[model samples]
Target chain A: MRSVLCYGYGNPGRQDDGLGVALVEQLETWAMAEKIPGLTFDSNYQLNAEDALAIAGHDLVIFADATGEGADAFAFRRLVPHATIAFSTHAMAPESVLALCAELYGKQPPTWLLTIRGSAWEPNGALPAAAQANLAAAVVFLKEWLRRPPAAV
Target chain B: MNPEAEKVFNAGAARANAAYAGQRRNVTINPITRLEGHGKIDIFLDGKGDVERAYLQVPELRGFEVFSLGRPAEDMPQITSRICGVCPTAHHMAATKALDSLYQVEPTSAGKKIRELVYNAFTLEDHALHVFVLGGPDFIVGPEAPPELRNIVGVIGKVGLEAGKKVISMRRRVREITSYFGGKVVHPVLGLPGGVSKALKAEDLPKFKELATAGVEFAEWTLGVFKSIVLGNPEYVKMITSDAYTHKTCYMGTVDANNNVNFYDGVTRVVDCNGKEVCKFTAKQYRDFIAEHTEPWSYMKFTFLKDRGWNGFAEGPESSIYSVGPLARLNAADGMATPKAQAAYEEFYNTLGGKPVHHTLANHWARVIEMIYAAERIEQLVNDPEITSPDVRRIPTALPTEGMGIVEAPRGTLFHHYQTDVNGLITMANMVVATGNNAARIAMSIDRAAKGLIKGGHVTEGLLNKVEMAFRAYDPCLGCATHTLPGHMPLRARIYNQSREIVQELVQD
Candidate 1:
């Protein structure tokens, strides 16, 4: 059985910043309804090095998170192993989690960083209309991708 | 919940929502912000740039008490497990034990062994994470290293990559053990009123045996790393024993009849600053000995010994401000329950000069030793003959009533109290979390360290980190400390176990 993971990271309390977390919520429902096996889903405020262990042993891992610096829709980048030890602390960058997987566990499978463009960041902000639309598009794309996670970006 | 506590939570949440702007008069470090629940360190300085006071404030807007009022008592372990990811096992176990008392039943011998095995494994995982990632930087990397280099990365840079790999491998193994026992990796769902929801099968014995043996080897390796990098260095040793990071606070923990530290179950022991036994109290009598005092400025309550009284955060034998966790556990007990930890405990006191060592930095060393014991205890529990027995639970047959449960959480003693109606619905709920127990000392340690390092009006990043080191040693869970309200983490109520009769499920939309 091929193992695949989908991790969404963001603070759900924040408005549009919760886009990634919302996607995770949607994916959780989809996973249960569809009864997907060897498919794992997780969500956290941010990624930690321990997340590397979480994503370990998976053939493919999709990292979804809110990105304010990205385009209106979303962008995907294939992640490669690199030294990100210096970029670790209270939270970690998604790339750093992959780097940790390679350095600490000896093998980091092919991974993708899916940056869902967020429109706002607020302590009590709700999901914005724009980010919601973008999330819908991203979800549609990932629904097909879950059937066959790409070999590369 | 009290109105005054509610008022405090509102006030704290308002203040915590502000930006992490370090004003000229103060500095903040190691603040957990945003969705993790806001916790910021504010160091108020005098006009001349001298330290006046330091406050570690955390926002408390979680309405757990109000929401859990009408819930079934049996589902508390599953419900409270979502409180924080840091110590879900601790909360689950505490809630499970509280159910045991409320239902007026005891777990069978196999159930007891299973609980102990899981708890020890959790201890091993939690302590390893703290010593290697959280508090490890200060000792593994040079304490005086730059702020950028003073983290787990620096520890990896100093200690070879193989050691780093072992650290991750060890933590992963223990987490797997917890997942196997608890029925889930992160949020476990296996606690029951009388016993656990599931039992360990014989097929999993070899896996656990491997995990326990490997955990022992990893713990020994961690100690060796501490010995070579921390104790082996004269400067680090001196700093650990130095007065800057030292406080003469009383100690408290749970101990067996032989006065040995026991994490699962025992009487609560309290000792003076001089290591003399003050009193030992049972779980039911915790209110008589321990009392929590509220400060209007903070949401979390400050706990102090009732006999000693609240002496305004004063540190001494005369004060009720006692410390907990590994240092306190070792100090309050005569010795460790395991051979390896016992030897380490002896060397720790011998080098530091006597019982109840006041040096707070030695908390890291004490934490590592406890990890050693936790690993060894796992080995023993796994080898127990009844570990796989089918006799694990007894159905409750008594009326629901008030009950109290206490256990040694990774940080310290965790207390849970609940009062239920005849129909087995919760009426009252209260808790004294381990981090909340260390509030007085966390404040004191941060204040004293800020005073010592922020002198001469030149506040550098190094100085701020030094202050943070003091609080990090306690391994304080600011999220849980201020977890009065789930302002950030929205909870959903689902059917935990629906085989029952008349269990209503309601949640905030």
Candidate 2:
């Protein structure tokens, strides 16, 4: 079965840190309507590389997280798996998690890390305006992504 | 069919169950959807007929304040825009507002006008999204309707093709306008300390004018649909009329010289129900007037009007103090501006007895009124000659190190305060988003709604839906409320019987 795993990873309880989680929540709803059969949807909070190993066999893994570095929330770009994850606030870095999955499972799932720009990470997750705006654009993007057929490669 | 009756039945069943004979129960809802952030609801049911304690849990790990510590001030507007999608313009604007305060330089007339126009663009988009996309689904499809149908897609099915298209088109128009100024709708990067980064030119004027006109038409149509569906409908009318819930108003918002709608800048005023101002203060004075309450169960912070201090929840028909957002702003304003909306506002006030409209359910009415106001404002703004001026931004001074900005978001008034070093890197920051202001009110409403409607037995679809709808009315953003997911989201709705015993607890897997 060809499955599409969409992980919107963020700590919404953490202000700008929640961009990833908030986006995934929106994507999950959009996927329910647009994602076809043989496709399963999953979303989780920030995870470690060990947790990433659990998703090793999924056909495609798309991860969304908030980066203080990005200037905008919907600034979508393809990042190589080699991108460093040490700066990530998550329990484990994205690169480390994917690397562990590949080393253990022989082949890691194809992935895309969509980083939404954030302003602050207050103690109680009070997201910034930029992160909030990203929610809508991210949804539209996910809808578009689901509309496309899976890559032949 | 009787939503309130379900509550009575549940209460009766609780008394029958020995386990709940004398227990104090606490129930929490992690994320209430349809807004930017997530929040929780915790109610303590005393063994008797009343609620002993109720807490609204907005469990968010504070992010905005800490993360911006080392970032430069020039990036504040763009960075702050990340706070919420529904009101990024306000965030960006407010950040600039704070920088303006820090610099002690009044924006050029052209700059202020452009900022106001930008703010209004957000108003048009945010308000429309809330009423139609977020709050619309519940009212349009009916709360008891299935989950699948409680969305914009469901709205399309009932209202037909054109209405849905209008909504999508309006959203797109707002998005286009946002992009024109800030480059994109999410986390717009246009505004800076001295002024905006982009200047409006002659070419964009016509498009702006066209969109404004289209938005006004769309708003009028949308309002009519809302009237027929929620306010005019016999079922909804009955549900709201029932004595299950009520609140009093000590409302606040920014207003213009004539005490009309002002989203960008104005004196902050708190008015009573009779259209009398309780107190008026500038945005800078907010620190003295507002008091914040934090709880362990929820991450969201609750703000209370400080003059009278914390008044325990309101009793039946007495109306307790609650505020912010469109409803609160309308209550605080002297009157609506546009003749059409003003006339509508007068009718709305007369029907509801004007000013300090305390019922949380009344937020729906308040939201509709703002949509009308935004349309009117959009028309007047686009027509203004100043909008086409090229002097949209000014070079900000690098002197001041601290500043604050405030604007009314779709949900309520949002505040952003920041301190930067001489080099412009942020040293400290504080923010009070919309949902936080409504935190106490949300819990109070939930407690009232649950107590008045759910007695704790079998969860009837109508009863459960009404309780959920009460939260939905605020367009509560659980995403903004909950910063961390507990490994996975927990879906649980539990109802206890009258004797304070557990009756039914359903968990969604």
lDDT of each: 0.74, 0.64
TM-score of each: 0.82, 0.72
Q: Best-fitting candidate, measured by lDDT?
A: 1
Evaluate model 1: give its TM-score: 0.82
Scanning candidate 1 chain B in windows of ten residues, the lowest lDDT window is B493-502
Clashes of each: 6, 71
Task: Say which docking band candidate 1 falls in.
Answer: incorrect
- The digit string of per-residue lDDT tens for model 1 on B1-509 reads 24565465444334422311323123222233333334455554445655555566655434455556888988678666645556778888888889989988988878878888889998988888888776887778876786556556667878978788778777877877877877643346767877776788999899889988999888888899999999999998888887779988889999999999999988999998989999999888999999988764466788999987876666666878898999999999999988998999999999899898988889899999999999999999989988988888878899989878888999999998889999989999887888888888887797678768775456655565677678778887765311111112211121111121112222211
Clashing pairs in 1: A15-A125, B61-B485, B62-B484, B62-B485, B62-B486, B63-B485
> Which lDDT tens digits does candidate 2 get at residues B134-196?
566667777777665654446556777566556755765765676777773333667766777
DockQ score of each predicted structure, in the order shown: 0.15, 0.06
